[model samples]
Target: MLLPRCHRIKQPASRSLFQSRPAGRLFIFMKRIGLTGGIGCGKSTLVDYLIGQGMCVVDTDQLAREALSPGQPAYDTVMESLKGACRLEDGTLDRSALGHLVFNDDKKRRWLEGLLHPVIRQAWESRLHTWDREGCPMAVVVIPLLFETQAQDLFDHVICMACSEKEQLHRLLQRGWSQEHIQQRLKAQWSLKEKMDASDGVIWAEGPLSSTFQQWDQIYHRIVSP
Candidate 1:
């Protein structure tokens, strides 16, 4: 059975950019929800469901990819930072090479984050402002490192998706990730337990598609309704 609506939940304290004033009083406001989870935890699947339900979803990963593309703001800096190690002959980024480099080295990973994070933040904020101006009722921003980047403050509520660690590893392996790469990526983020404890809601993504969708439907109604 689905969980009941959480009527006792408190309103967010900080005002978001989407809040609107009407007749001298605040009225409608867009609820900015952050959906996050570790890599290979099926966040994209949940995001698709939300998009299908008519919620505006701003995927940070998409923004990052754009930012890293040639002629984008982060592209030159990233290539320079990597010292051409991950630059392809066609003047594009070699993602696999870059991934292998940074995931294994703490300093390089931090350096890369430093370069890309500001650009990603700017893009995210810009999109939110656009959606707010368009009067979107709610938006879900997918930030894979929401907690890691200390960006939880940007959302009205957070939903963390989780699965068993064994399942997590298995899923990544199915994606052709090496065991070492999987471990490195996992170690880079906050544990699932930590994310779950900090979030307003949790979605266990260990079961069948129908079950996951059911949970998502319940959570979606709760968030989109009063």
Candidate 2:
């Protein structure tokens, strides 16, 4: 149910709630849509489909990885705060080791979030500004922690991609993750129920890919049409 892109271009929607900079003429034509989901809910796959549809898509997970890579400011701060124990032999942050450390310990988890969230948010905003000027069809940001970080207000619309817990566990198993790893990651965020309650829309990923795309198509039309 997508309105033609030209219709969106001719009659833009109101400015996005997540937009920080001025909604220049270009951005006036673009809408910012956020897609969030838990560890095994298939958000990445949906984002890829959106990108294929000619939308600008940014994966905050990828940005977080970049922000924490060796020599990045975030990398430096994390290593300094934890006193070098979070590093691997190659001097890069041992993400798996760090994950184990924080996932089980509330105190360490808070400290890690305190250090990383601000940096990642800033990076995300920068990318958002850059893309807004490019006059893309629309923009999609994949933020796994959208609700956990209280960033739901940062987008024009927030979509939660969800699945049954049984399906979630099954998906995680397919990824070769241990049951303990799955539960540990899931425990770190707001539960699926909470995420849906907070989002403007919900795309249940338990069905076929075509069904998921159909939901996405409807979302794009709702947001982008003048």
* All candidates: TM-score: 0.89, 0.83
Scored against the true structure, residue 183 in model 1 reaches a CA lDDT of: 87
Q: Which stretches of candidate 2 lie over 4 Å from their true place?
A: 1-29
Q: Residue by residue across 63-146, what tens digits does model 2's lDDT show?
A: 888889988988988898889987888888888888888887889898878888898889878888787666555678899999
- Alpha-carbon RMSD, candidate 2: 6.1
The segments of candidate 1 whose C-alpha lies over 4 angstroms from its true place after superposition are: 1-10, 14-27
Error of 2 at 45 (Å): 0.9
Judge candidate 1 at residue 75 and give its lDDT.
89
Q: Model 2: what TM-score?
A: 0.83
TM-score of 1: 0.89
* lDDT of candidate 1 at residue 9, scale 0 to 100: 28
Q: Residue-wise lDDT of candidate 1 within 36-131, one digit each (tens)?
A: 877877899988887888878889998888888998768888877668788889998888888889999999899989988888988888888888
Candidate 2: which pairs clash?
18-154
Instruction: Give me the overall lDDT of model 1.
Output: 0.80
Tell me, by lDDT, which candidate is best.
1
- Superposed by TM-score, candidate 1 places the C-alpha of residue 131 at a distance from the truth, in angstroms, of 0.7
